[model samples]
Each structure stands twice: as C-alpha cells, then as structure tokens.
Target: MATVYLDYNAGAPLRPEVAAAIAAAWAAPGNPSAVHGPGRAARARIEAARAEVAALVGADPAGLIFTSGGTEANAALLAGLAVPRLLLSAIEHPSLAVAAAARGGEEIAVGPDGVIDLADLDRRLAADPRPALVSVMLANNETGVIQPVAEAARLVHARGGWLHCDAAQAAGRIPVALDALAADFLTLSAHKMGGPPGIGALVLADPSRQLASLLLGGGQESGRRAGTENLPGIVGFGAASALVGDDLAPDGPTFRVGALRDRLEKLALARVPTARVIGAGAPRLGNTSCLALPGLAGATQVMALDLAGIAVSSGPACASGRQRSSRVLAAMGLPDTVAGSAIRVSLGWASTDQDVDRFVAAWGELAGRKGFTVSAPQAA
Candidate 1:
C-alpha cells in the first residue's frame, strides 16, 4: 500500500539537493541587503542562485527579479508593466487571469486543443491601437498543452505590443529560453520544479524596460520587487534548477515520465469506455494527462484515489478548498459535466513505472465499481 504522488503540477516534492541547500542557507544569519561582511556573504549566495536560475531560462542574471512566488511575480508584471491595454489567453492560470481581470484586461480565446488563437490575437491587436501587453502561458497547467509562445511573441512585437510568458509550468519540464521565446517578461516558480515553495522569479529580457516596483520597501531586487530576499528558498530554487539540466531532452527524465503518462491514459481509456484524454491532439508536456470520466465527479475520483493512497488532482492545487469545474477544460469547449469530471494526473522526475501501474489498477477498479464497461473508445 505504498502511496504514489502524481500531482506534480500542483507542487512537486522537494528534491534532496534542494532540501540540503535550504538547510545550509538557513544556517546563515545575515540580510542580503546589509553592507556588513556577513551581508556581503549573503549577497554573494543570493547572486550565485540568481545566476543559476537565470541560466535555466536563458535570461540575464541582472534582469531577473526574485519574488515571493509565481503568483506575486505574475501580479507584479500585470500591475507594473506600463501598458495601456492587457490581453491574456483564456487558458492562463488563475493568478494571471485574476490579475488581468483586476486590471480590466481582456481574454483571447483558446481553441479546442487548448492552444491560443493567433488569428484572434492579430485581430484584437489591430482593433485596438493602444500599446498593449500580451500574457500567454508557455504550457497549460491542466492539460500540459504547449502554446506557440514564440509565434505569439512575433505577432505581439509586430503590433508594437510586448509579450509576457507565464512559464511556471514549463520551466523545469521543458527547455525554456527567454530569448528563444522572444518574451519581454517571463515568470518562473520554484515549487513547481521541485524547489522550495516560497520563492520564484520574474525575468526581464531588456534591462532597460521600466518596471514599477510592486513592494516599496528595502529596495531589494534592484527596486523592481522590494523586500528582503528569501535566502533559503532562493538557494533551494537554485539547486533545483541546476538538477533540471537536460531533463527536457528526448531521452531525458521528462520523456520517460511522459511515456508513463501516455501508458496511464491508454490503460484508463481501454478500461473505461467513457474516459477520454483532454487535449490529446495537441503537443503537451510529457508529464501531464487530463482524464475526463463522463459520469463521475472529479471530487469523487480525487477522494477515491486518495483513499487508495494515490495522489492526483482535479485542477490546479491553488484552487484546493474551492473545487469547481475546470476553467481550462471549459475553455477547450468541454461541456460542464465533462469538464467537472476531469482530473489531472501529472508525473515528475521522481515518478516511476510502479506509480503508473498502481494508479491504473486503482482507477480501473473504481471505474468498474462505478458501472463503466471495460471497452476501448472509438477513434475520434
């Protein structure tokens, strides 16, 4: 009865190296901003971590601002960027979506594959002559479908608009280059990549871009994000980023994990006639599978899986206590029932074949008990 954790998208388990780094950093006692000897030592540690993190995304170390987490980083960008109008994809994370909405930002629709509509973006940009800031996620949190961020950036730049990419879900699982994506701003979360949960970063492509400070104290993070840095968390984040090297390669850990995800989806679809994999047709992250069980509620399935000592989730873990229909699936045009019944099963670097097999067996038993026939679904 070993427990299998499959909800990496929520927050990956902390890596041993990251934990060790955190422990070491916690032993130091000096504010990074202080000019004293201990402070200089602390500042050096923070700068080293910054370099490690910046390298992961091909960003200039000086241009990266450490924030509390992905949410704060996103909030700072959405609020601080000097753009008259903001446009974001409908499938963006709640943090981005809520921040955009609060600023009276409009949403660009995503297609059934959960990919942003480029034509709609062009039209929207043309319809409005105002200087705009476009936010599009690099990969979807629920379905793991990768977006055409580089292409979107080209469009945004052509129209004199800046492109901001939320790469929280894509950073460690894939190769994310700020230059390759051509994003003006990019967001990264450490917790999503097996690092400490309290620290994340906002990467700026241009060091000269005007960024209004979100927090106005201490003048930390080059006065872009004010506040004392989370030393231990930043250390952990750096350790985790270093370990993610080449994991996004074809023969890397991520590719193997994706194979496991595909196997799980294939097994589920074969055992439960009504089960379908959402966003299967699109290019998705190797470690994520969004399974929709037509007649079963996602909450019910989540609880049942938990009872079996398996960890899975209905949607973003950020929405834990307020479970509802997945906005991501809905944006993909799934009906309320289908979207509500969808559960996301995400793998990680620590995932193995046994975890996948155990989940499949448990899910099959549950589906059988729910009166679902064991038959393969017809091809779409």
Candidate 2:
C-alpha cells in the first residue's frame, strides 16, 4: 500500500527546486575560502545563498552564521553565552535545553495551554539582578504551539537581558522576523523548511556583536563558526527559503494546511469521543495537531498508523528516531496517560484534502481497535 507522509515537523521532504540547486552547486569545484578564480566563484555563490536565507527572516546577511543544522546553531549560541543566569522555558527542544543546562540554566513554567507564563518569566528575571539570557522556542516541534517570544523579548530587554528563539519549527511554516520578534538570537533549520537536511543558520540582531567561536583555527562564519561550509546544503537552503514567500500570504499554503489540521482533529474527536487535542488552547502552527487517546500508548498509535500506511510521530522524533512519550505534554500539566498516548500529525506543503480524509479513516480505525500488535513506527 502507498503511504501518506504526515510528519513534516520531523523533517519535511526536500523540495524539487532545492534538489536542482544542490545539483548545480555540487558541480562547483572550489572551497568558499580559497583566494583563486574558482574560489571567488564559490564565495559569490555562498554570499548569494546567505542573502537569500537572510531575506526569509528579515535579517542582515552579515548577521547570519551557517551551521551543520539547527542543533549546532542552538548549541553554539548557548555555549558561548557568558551570563550570570540562564532561563529556559519548560517546553524547549532538547538542543536548547541540553546546552543551556550545561551553563546552569533554570526552567521557567508554562501554562496548561503550552505557552510560556510571562509571570513566571518576570519572577525569574526579577529574582536575578545580573544579566540573564532566556531561551524560548518560537513554535514547539511536538505540539505545534507557538510561544510568546516577542512578549518575552520585551520583558527580557526591560531587565537588560537577551532572548534566544529557536525558530526551527516556526520558520517556513509561519512568519518570523528578527526585528519584529526583537530576539537577540534566532536559529533556523533547513530540513524543517523543505530544504536539505544537515544545514541551518543562526542570526544575530547586531552584526558587529562579538560571538565566541564554536570551532577554532579558521575564519569561516567570520570566525564565529569555523569549518568548510556545506556548499550544496547551503545552496539548497537558499532555494527552499526563496519558495517560502508565496506560502506566507493571507490565504496561502499554510492557511490550507491549518484547515486540514482542524479537520483532522475534528474527525478524530468525533470518531473517538475520549480523544484529547494536546495544546489546542494555544495559538499553533497551522500544519500540526497533537492528538491523544486515553488507553493507547503513543508507540502503539505510531505503529498502527505505520501499518495503515500513514506516517506520523509518537512525539517529536528524537535524534534516534525512537517512539518516545512527550515531555512537551508533561510540561503542560497533562495527565500521564494523555502525555503517553499523544501522537503528532503534521501536514506540510504537499498535504491535500484526501490526505486528511485517509488519515482520519485510518486513525478512527486504529482508535476503535480492540487490541494492538506492536511494531516499529516508520517515521519516514
């Protein structure tokens, strides 16, 4: 049977334009840092890609630092911060959580709606007079709930602190701007935005700000990050970023996907009256839905969907692609069963009405089943 892919948040499929761009970039035979003729050509291509990627987030091209992916961008930025206190939201991605924890970061509370509690943030910020760096993801990968980064930014700025937003899940799905959000640091992932994987970027609001190097012995990324850049991956990222403009308009691809997500949750709720939509109370990206049933384990749900030829994630597919219960739902004060049973169905650019219909049919059947035989989920 043919499979319907619904796990865009895990990693969107590579776009055709990006693939073509990568092919063209791969044929170029010089390093971006060399001083020769081919090197100048390579450097020009890299600069062009930088401008394209910067345009997507309304950032200065000089402020962007390309990395291996979003994980590295978050890690490098957090690692370099020399703050007296570091505050993290309860719902941060592992990259931010882990890196901030290494520097003695404290967790701030979030409401049951899966949004950051500005009061808790205020308390944390006020509790410490020293400068603090705050980490809040723009949109969550698992629940798709959007966070109040801009409001947090204002508060942090008032307290003479800086805010870092991991826009990995927000960037090509919803609108993001460095100035509009007033974030000191913002990160983006290529694969999450229909580009090639293994490449991403971090943007600084002020290009002249001194950033500590993630790597030493080279001047790449103006010495903030040192390594030979992934030329083709960067090219593909630029190509994908160029495609996002048409999708962000008033009634564009994102709006349609949001409708499909609503339809999905509606059908799931009608078919299984006990079903719960995690993070439904908050503003979320249009492409994602987190649904939970009372009795089923999320792994069981993922396997059932896999058997039915529908692809979804039990939670955010971690680095290992393992089916894991959601920390995001637990952070929202959900019951253990609700958190354990939640699965993420994320639509994207290629999603259609038929895809939603088939998913609802498959999901209803699985939820209605008397028993389940276990297997691995194909998080493809």
Over 1-380, each residue of candidate 1 has an lDDT whose tens digit, in order, gives 67999999999999888999999999988999899998999999999999999999988999999999999999998778778999999999899898778889999999999999999999999998987999999999999999999999999999999999999999899899998999999999999999999899999999777788988976888878777889999999999899888777778888888788888887778778688999999999989999989889999999999999999999998888666798888888999889999999999989987898788878888888898876533221
The residue ranges of model 2 lying beyond 4 angstroms of the native Cα positions read 319-324, 371-380
Which model scores highest in lDDT? 1
Q: lDDT for model 1, on a 0 to 1 scale?
A: 0.90
In model 1, what are the clashing residue pairs, if there are any? none
Across 339-380, the per-residue lDDT of candidate 2 in tens digits comes to: 888888999988887888788778777865745332222221
Taking every candidate in turn, the Cα RMSD to the unseen true structure, in Å, is: 2.3, 3.8
- What lDDT score goes with residue 323 in model 1? 69
Candidate 1 wrong stretches, greater than 4 Å: 375-380
Worst 10 residues of 2 by lDDT: 371-380
RMSD of 1: 2.3
